[model samples]
Target: MGLIVQKYGGTSVGTVERIMRVADRIIEYKNAGNDMVVVVSAMGKSTDVLIEMARQIAPNPSAREMDMLLTTGEQVSIALLAMALQQKGYDAVSLTGWQAGIATESVHGKARIQEVDTARIRSELQRGRIVIVAGFQGISEKGEITTLGRGGSDTTAVALAGSLRADKCEIFTDVSGVYTADPRVVPMAQKLDSISYDEMLELAILGAGVLHPRSVEAAKKYKVKLVVRSSFSQEEGTCVEEAADMETGRVVSGVAHDEDIAKITVVGMPARVGTLSRLFNTLAGAQINVDIIIQSSYDAAVTNISFTVSSDDLVRTLDTLAAYQEALGFDKVEHESGLAKVSIVGAGMITNPGVAAEMFQQLAEQDISIKMVSTSDIKVSCVIPAEQTSLAVRTLHTAFGLDVAEQAVVHGI
Candidate 1:
């Protein structure tokens, strides 16, 4: 029998009926003679509700205490799903992160997994029990409760699969599979049958939201195969592996977009080499993330730098730059909010000539200006006005021939 690791998202376990549906999905795998270990997230909106409740009590709650409170959501999901499986006449047991031996870094809100002690899970499987794990939360070596940041459950599931040396990891969610673009934004977005690890990593980082970037990173590092499909359907789904089928001959695989981006520009700085390094170091000290940096030079020794950060980090980023302004030796800082980043990603584009040119030409035709640009061998991203994200995504989806004849369902729409 092959050993398998699977994870279901919040929407898949949101209600009793939905939980029952997921249990049925699990039973099919079990009956196929596979040893099963399932991971699950909190019920739909429950984590959000808990966060709002905590913020209601205090605008800024302690991260450690928040981890203690937020983990209860997944606890609820695991117990209920375990009960559901048992009621369906299957032997099942639920184990929280600590009980299952998932050890992570001491960081509370966004801890990274350090190791997995698989003795307990292996024992349970040998006893003919389906093991259920609480995803997204784990215990640190110092005995602190910690959570993987948003979509960390994907990380948890994949981590388990790698540690246990399972055959493959299956990530079931509300959406059927990874798409060329978010179906909600672009109705004609087509689902991809398969994608390479590098392409998925870019999508996840660029706000695909279908899979977590950390999980993709782990999959590549460990060489574990991943399948993303909807828990609610029997679609073929998308397979993520080291090398994907390249027979499609499509230069650009998909267009991904992220709204709620803000830009910070530091004006009039010496073109000295370490100036840029020290300036970014200031933000790094504050744990602020930077993306898409562009530098403009007026003359040989004077330059201006513009960089993008998620809007959620705008205040922190601006304050960080201002505090170091005098030390960093910049004339002034300028800021812009409500910007969006739309990117086209594909491994096939590596050998395709003029792929970025095609993207620019299409955007130019629609009069959508590109503010900041970032590129890799397989991806090109343009930051445009937030209000124009939908237009930009759809325009590029068709431009790259990623559209299907039918509309796609937008979960949570």
Candidate 2:
């Protein structure tokens, strides 16, 4: 029998009863003769509760301390899950990230894994025991506790599967599978049977949230197969692999939207050699991420550069830029909130023409004004008013022939 690694998100093991159910699923797999390794996130809303408590204790907590506190969330999941399996008469063991040999960079709250020592995991599997390891956390080379930022647990599972050379990796979440759009938003969003690594990576990065981009990157690097399925269902999940079926069906596989966007514009900047580099490097030094940048000629002598960042980062971004104002050689800056970004992603776009044009046309037809734009071989993103996000996504989804069954649905906007 093949070795398999599985990861259950917070919602999957949100309650003690759910943990027992997961244990049963694990037993079924083990009974089938496959070696099992399971990775799990903190239980539902526990991480948020922890963060809220930390905020109450101190408005601004140290990232190191935050990492220390946050890592415990997954520790709880692993231990409780292990107990559930053991109570069910299955031999199971729980290990934290460090005990499982997950090593990471020294960075706190956003560490990247450096290596995985499979000795302990392999030993457990050899004994016919199911191993439950904590996800989203690892010890730094300096022995500091660290986290992999948002969606780190997904990376943890995929990385372990790769290191173990497991036959496959399965990501069990609340949703049954990956969809063309968020099914909650676009009720007719189609579930993809299989998606290519490139397409899935784009969708994940574009804000699908079904799987994290880091996990997809690891899967691609190690050539590991990934399946995203429902934790509570027997339905087959979406397969993420080398090639997808997009070549035959829809030219646009999905429309993705992010409502946490905020826009910042550095006005009247001299269009000199080091202007762009200096400005962005400052943001990078501040660890602020920038997305969907556009530079325009405010005048020949000065250009206006605008970009987007998370609303949470908007204040930090502005403060960082203000600190470097003279160095960046910009006249003034402006900021705007209540913004969003929406995009269409598919591998077929690489060989297809006018996809971006069609997307812009779809948004235009909905009277949605595009503020900024970014395009790649497989995707195109536009920033627009947050209120129009749902309309934009549904409009583009239907326009791309992605929801043929809902062809008669009214354009509600």
Candidate 3:
């Protein structure tokens, strides 16, 4: 029998009823003669609640302690799911990240999976037990608990599937499948039947919430077959794999937007070979991820550099820059919140000309001012005001003909 790895997000196993429902689903898969490995996130909003508790205790708690506290959310999920399976008269076993042999780097809040020793998982499966693993967490070489950052459970499942060489890895979430754009923002967004790993990775990194970017990276690296679907329905899901030719079908695969963005500009900086490097190195040391960077030079001697970061990291980023402002010789540091990043992604864009021009033309026509811009072979991202995010998404969705027609249907199997 083939082995299948499935991951349920926080919302899928949010409540007692949902946990029981997930148990039933696992049982059904077992009856189909497949060895099952299930991974699950914490119950709905539990992680958030835990974070709130920590913040209440201390405004800036220790990252090591936070990791210790956050991993418990998935621990509760795994144990309860195991109990539900047993109540249904099925053999089941639950494993935490350490118990399942997931070894990670020592980074407390955002550890990366170093390797997965799957001997325990194999033993449990051989005993005719469904294996449920706590997602989003792992033990470090230092014997400390480390939690992967947000959406890390998705990475956990894909990494497990890769290590086990499972037949398929299914990601079950609240959304039915991957759409051309967020269905909440664009009602006409169509669900894709299938997508290339490159396109899906771009979408994930650009803010498509259906799957995690790290999971997509792992899947692509290991050639793992992935399916994304809704736990709430029986509908067929979107398959992610390598395509014969990425540019063969549609020119634009999807439009993704993130409203959780803030922009920072280092003004009146002397232009030098190491000035840019020094500025960014400081941010990297602070663990701030900079996106969509732009540099403008008014004269040969000085330049203005700007970049975007997640709004959550804005304060830390500013603080980091301020500490080094004198050393870096920057005159002033300015930042603005209430900004958004809008992006269009497709593998076909590599071969298609005018994709950027077309996107810019559409925004210009709508009087939506583009601030900073970044482009890769498959994607182009622009920073704009947060209030105009929905309008930009809708406008681009229609501009690229990504909007679904009335009575349109998604065909999948």
Candidate 4:
């Protein structure tokens, strides 16, 4: 029998009835003659509710304690799911990330997986038992519970699949699969049957929100076949595999938009070598992530450098840069919040030219002014006013022919 690893998001196992429903699906897979390993995230809104509770008690909670408190959400789901499976007459055991052998670095809030020792999981699978493991939480070498940042559950599932060499890794979530655009905003957005890992990574970064980029990287590195399906439906979901397996070469696969970005422009800096380095080094020291960097060298004497960072870090990033103002000798640092980043992703965009021009033209027709633009081989991103995000997404979705006539209803777990 083949080994299959499945991951259920918060919504899938949110309630007692939902947990039982998941158990039935797991049993169906087991009855099909496949050994199963399931990964579960925190129940719906449990983590957020816990975080709110923590905030009520303490304005600034310690990261260690916060992780300890937040991880309980997934623990609760694993136990409930295990109980549901056992009630159905199928043998099941729940294990925490640490118990399942997921080892990570010592970073408290945003730890990275160092390695996974699958001895316990392997032994349990060999015993003809369905193993349930908590996702998003892992143990550090110091024996502390650490989380893998946002979307850690996806990373955990992919990592487990890689370490176990499972036949497939199935990600069950609220959405059926990856779509050409968000269906809520673009009613005609078509579901992609297959996508390459690179395109998926770009889409994830651009706010497609189906799969985490880290998970995609892990799957690509380990060559694990990943499927995204709806927990509420039985229909076949999208498969993310290597590019060679895909037949179609559409220039645009999807449109993704993020409205949580702020642009910071360090204007009128000396154009001398290492000037920009000094400015960015300060931001790096403060642990801020900068995206979409653009530098214009007007003359040999001065340059205008601009970049984007999360809105949450706008103040901190500005303060950090301000601290180095004297050393870098810049004119001033200005920031614009309430900005959004909209991106178009496709695997075929690398070979196809004029895709960016068309994207810009469409946005212009809608009177959406683009503040900045960035392009990679497979993706194009533009920064615009946050208010124009929905309009821009709908426009781009229609421009790319993503609107479908009939909406596909998803089925099965």
Candidate 5:
């Protein structure tokens, strides 16, 4: 009805032909009488290729330079899409993240958006032109280029939608919509018609890959409606919003699995009152996101603390723990990188029992061993062997009755 923000991922605009198709799609939306602001990621594998090129030049390039180099990918995307739209006799313009007024902190490669100055975007919108903004990047207060980390394009789109007060934010991904499990892994995985913001946030943070957690956070905070669909098809996709009414009987909404996880254990720490606090605070100071933490007191005088972090942070986490060994008073620090986290999320799980038991039983039937376990009101995540990730996902997907009968939709409502 009013302004809408649309985002296309790398695969959606991978080539000139794809870019033309995307332009046509945008034109159709414009013809529908709605103002449009589009966000786009780099062409397929272009960002990875750039990273490889940078590593070829320097083994460990500076994060600041990486941001400068990586932002070019999205710029390429915006420029090409704008050119395609113009070639089709449509009024279109391209703007980089900073040109569109995206301001961020000075965190070189992984900056969070601080605020958006919408004057430039609003000005372009008033001229009846489709504005294509580079996604995943912005500028810092010190006039430095900064990139939002992985899946940042989704964050950019959602943030822009909130700032513009857009009617909806459409995320055009490779998948038709959010699924009960990864369809590639579980053939029976069903696409959801709608999901709550909190459920979607949990799935994204747990590695759903359809949307980013930060984007869902912004959507929930600003009450932005989100529609996730495929760029390649016109299939009706999923709507993510606040569930109007909480229903009973459905305990497990979806199963999420992540392979990019590593666990660090600080073993035999002095059983002091503030040992856990000091250990975690030290990791926090390093900006490492710890997930799925586990602690046990093996004896009266000693305790074991284990936590998971991104695989990229595993080395740094181990190094930090080793450096602070004396301060943390831990006898040994061990790290495991060959682990995966498999989780099931459902809002109904808070009031429903036996969900975790069923999940654990299914995994056990599949001969999967759980290494570390973490539970929230709505989620139960377990760390297991990375190799068994797919098996675990499939098992749990079927166990939770998430599979379809004749079609890919779950049986019944």
Candidate 6:
């Protein structure tokens, strides 16, 4: 029998009925003659509720205590899932991150997995028991409980699968698999059956949200085969692996868009070596992530640097730049919120000519202006007004033939 590791997201095990459904699925895998290990996120909305509760008590709760509190959500899930499986007549046992020997660094909010001691899991499996693990949380060397940050459960599952050397790591979420676009916005977007790790990484970063980027990175590094499937259905889902041949390549795999973006432009700066460094250093110090940077070389001894950051950082970023404006000798600092980033991700685009031209032509035909442009080996992204995001996404989806024969409908699980 081969060992298999499966991870269920918060929506997959959201309720008592859903937990029982998940238990039934695990039992089926066990009956199929494969050793099963399951990792689960907190029940649906539990983490958010806890966070809201903590906010109610204190505007800024201590990170250590917050970690201690949020980690309990997943603890509740694994324990309940184990009990459900046992009630269904399967040999099952649940273990928290500490009990399962997930050793992590001292970082409380975004702890990285140092190592996973698989002794207990192996022993339980050898005794013909299905092992359940609480995802997203680990214990430090000093016995302090720590939590991996948002989407940490995905990373936890991949790490466990790598350490256990499982045959496959399956991530069960609310959706069936990765799609060509956000189906809610583009109703005709189709789900992909397979995708390359590199393409998947671009999609995740571009807001596809099928799998977390960190999880995909770990899976790629460890050479673990990953499947993104729905917990409610048995249909085949998307498989992510290393690209083997050009035959599987598609011209445009998907279109991704992000609405939580703001643009900051340092305009008319005196052309100098240290100007860019000082500006970016200030932003870095404020813990703001700057994305899609474009700089114009100086002809009149003035350079313009434009970049995108999260909308929430707009105020602080502008303030920080203004604080250093006089010292940096910039003419002015301009900021705009309510901007969107639309990225077209595909592996075949690198060798295929006319892809960029086609995207630009389509946007132009629709009267959608491109504010900024960024390109990589496998993707091209453009910034546009937030109001035009849906139009751009739909236009690109149609231009690239990502639309399905039938319309797609969105429903919550």
The lDDT per prediction is: 0.92, 0.90, 0.92, 0.91, 0.90, 0.89
State each model's C-alpha RMSD to the native.
Answer: 1.9, 3.3, 2.5, 2.2, 3.0, 2.8
Q: Candidate 1, which segments miss by more than 4 Å at Cα? A: 299-302, 409-413
The per-residue C-alpha lDDT of model 1 at residue 115 equals: 95
Over 230-300, each residue of candidate 5 has an lDDT whose tens digit, in order, gives 89888889999886643445688899999999988889989988988899999988778899888889889
lDDT per residue as tens, model 6, 1-413: 68899999998898999999999999888889999989999999999999999999998688899999999999999999999998988889999998888999987776889999999989998999999999998999989999988788888889989999999999998778888998888989998888899999998888777687878988999999899988888878889988773245598899999898999889998887897888888888766679999889768698999999988678878888888888888889888888999999999898999899999999999999999999998899999999999999999999998888987544344
Candidate 4: the clashing residue pairs are 188-403, 188-404, 233-411, 233-412, 234-411, 234-412, 235-411
lDDT of 1 by residue, 1-413 (tens): 79999999999899999999999999999999999999999999899999999999998688899999999999999999999999999999999999999999988787899999999999999999999999999999899999998899999999999999999899999888999998877888888888889999999999899999999999999999899998888877899987645444768888999997999999988899798899888888777779999999999878999999999789878888788889988899999998999999988888988989999999999999999889999999999999988988999999898899998865532
Question: What's the TM-score of each model vs. the native?
Answer: 0.94, 0.95, 0.95, 0.94, 0.96, 0.89
User: Which residue pairs overlap in candidate 2's backbone?
Assistant: none
| Top candidate, metric lDDT | 3
* Least accurate 10 contiguous residues by lDDT in model 3: 404-413
Deviation in Å, model 5, residue 142 alpha carbon: 1.5
Quick one: ranking by TM-score, best first?
5, 3, 2, 1, 4, 6
1 against 6, candidate with superior TM-score = 1
How would you encode candidate 2's per-residue C-alpha lDDT over 1-413 as one tens digit per residue?
Answer: 89999999998999998999999999999999999999999999899999999999998789999999999999999999999999999999999999999999999887899999999999998898999999999999899999998789999999999999999999998887888888878888888888889988988888888899899999999999899998888888889888733345657888998899999999999988888998899998888878888899956799999999999789889899889899888999999999989999987788899999988888888899999999998899999999999999989887888784642221111
- The TM-score obtained by model 2 is 0.95
Local distance difference test, candidate 4: 0.91
